[model samples]
Target: MKTTLSTTFGLLMLSAAVMASATEMPVVKPLRGTVESVSNNTLTFTNRAGAQQTIGLTDKTGFVEVSKADIDSIKADSFVGSAAIPQADGSLKALEVTVFESSLKGSGEGHYGWQNADGSTGTMTNGTVGKLSKANGRTLTVNYKGGEKQLVVPDDVPIAYVEPGKKDALIKGAKIVAFPAGDGKNARGVAIGKDGFQPPM
Candidate 1:
């Protein structure tokens, strides 16, 4: 009787552990893609790998539009995200820069690794713009939580602005960076292109 009871307890504990893990939510990575079509609250798109994928969108799904911007759009106190490559002098040079809307001030508020459009790896820094200088090129001092980075935006670097968008903006050929839900097949939010502008970040 003692042996049987011990075995039963162990089985129950194992079953409970399995159940707990099964209910745990998944960590989802963002998906970058171009919209091919949208219908019935579903989005069909081609990802960076050129594979067709679909994600379901509900009424609660959020959308933000990215529009063409230039160096003139960035100013002191503006919140921005820049994808940059490090230079020999230790300062970073901007590959692309995004002027984030007020609501997105603290989004991705740190310096970390980012993948560029050309399949090269760089760093992404999202923070508040501090000072602006144009001595050589456009240099922006960006301040984040623990540190700050000085980024140089050259003449040819692409720039874009992010703003609130509606479902109508999700038309064909729009580029997007989608945040997936825990299931990985439903969209929580997306930053989609406005007009022909692709989301640089």
Candidate 2:
């Protein structure tokens, strides 16, 4: 009886540990697309590859709006996040850039791997803007914790700003970048487009 009780306790402890670890894992952003329809708790959208996807939204699913911005919206010391493709000259050519609101400073602060909508790999760098110049196009230095990067923004790249949004923003034709739960059928949060601007990241 003593050995059996010890085994049961050990099993319970292991199960609890596994559950805790699973709960702490980071949410994945695997769904990026434009919303086609939205029901009470479920939404259908078209992915970048032109496939339709339907996902459920929990009550806790959050939303934010990305509004159009221009290069003039960025300034020295502005906090920003840019997803860029690495150029042969060791600089980054931006695919899209976002000037984050003051309240969102330090959100996802890092230089890390990113996967583009076309399935190509890229890098996302979130940092403070430094030494911005537009002599040729738009070039700026991004300073993060450990290092800095110089990014070249082309004329056609999307530039935007993020702000709090309402659920009504998830209407038809809305483009979004949504973070999904582990199951991949439910959304944890989404950054949706507003005022004709798409959420590029």
Candidate 3:
């Protein structure tokens, strides 16, 4: 009995070490928050409510920072989300767009009708790209979240993409979207942004 207990405890300790070393990805939830530290290839950050998290990164882990782009850069089948205002003709005119990183392909895939800052009707949607149009600036359809919407992506729509950046970008004061790991309790970070260019988390 003594030997068996010892073995069991040893196994538990080993499992804990592995979990602390590198986190896993499950369904990809947002791990948005501020940074705490970066060591052993693991990023320690805090959530909006001030809860600290430690997530390790492997070679396959994605570390991308936001960069500027235009509406034309959006492509079909790309995972994206946007905040837009409703037009008179019943089309959403994009105000801001963010192209999600590959690790967050299906994260929070849905359509949300939100209120605009100016009291206008705003729609927030995230899903896979479907089609694009060149008439009237550009019209786009994103098919996911069990729904679809035709959006007028203006040529001047502010767009951002997660381009590859240095690992050090995950430093303190950095904002990141950490995907939930297999455990569903702790999170694993994949993409991050710095200098106030935050992802739509």
Candidate 4:
């Protein structure tokens, strides 16, 4: 993917800013930070840990914005993942559910901390949709790499999808994550989650 982080967003400049840790990582590692500045095809951002860095982009660079979606939009047999809170009766209630792109199947396929908005530690799992039950609440049977979990889908829970966007959307203070190709400093951004919503793992 080609990407060009432009210089200019609020006070962030892509061309005239900082860069750090040119170290190596796996094929595609997560690179997230706050927009400090941006220049055409390049941008400097400050990570959650307060480190500022610059990343390069090109025309093929992917730009997506994570926007809310409805639970009813989920389809059967679709590969999906959810951050859920365990219910009292051994059921899991989702805090966020994401219908993943096919290419992302098997990625982050296990359970992990959900960090629910309500403060309880929720569990996140990626799986295939089995069935949907509207009986008690909307319940979904989702299967993953090795196991399945019955999840309750609440209409109000926040679910998101990546949508196309322009560089203007990459404004200062916007939370963004750049998907690094092979070089640690230059890569294409797959998506940018708005308002600091956690990017789907």
- Give per-model TM-scores: 0.76, 0.77, 0.52, 0.56
Ranking by lDDT: 1, 2, 3, 4
Who wins the lDDT comparison?
Answer: 1
Which of candidates 2 and 4 reaches a greater lDDT? 2
Count of steric clashes across candidates, in order: 0, 0, 1, 25
lDDT of 1 by residue, 97-180 (tens): 989777656655667665566677677777899999976558999998999999999978889997767778888999987766
**Ten contiguous residues with the weakest lDDT in model 4:** 7-16
Q: What RMSD does model 3 have?
A: 12.1
| lDDT per residue as tens, model 2, 1-201 | 333332322221122223323434221234788899989789889998899998888776656689888878878998888888888988899999989777666655656666677777677777889899976668999998888999998878888997656678889999988766555677756778886567887
List residue ranges in candidate 1 displaced over 4 A: 1-30, 58-60, 181-183
On residues 1-201, what C-alpha lDDT tens digit does candidate 3 reach at each position? 333332322222123233433433111224567788888777788877778877766553445577666676788888777777777987777887777656556544566553333444456676788897687567789887567888877777678875445567877887776654446344333456658666543
Candidate 2's TM-score reads: 0.77
lDDT computed for candidate 1: 0.74
**Model 4, range 90-196, lDDT digits (tens) per residue?**
87887777765544444345444433334445566666788877765468888865678889987777677644456777778877857664445566454566776
- lDDT for each candidate structure: 0.74, 0.72, 0.62, 0.60
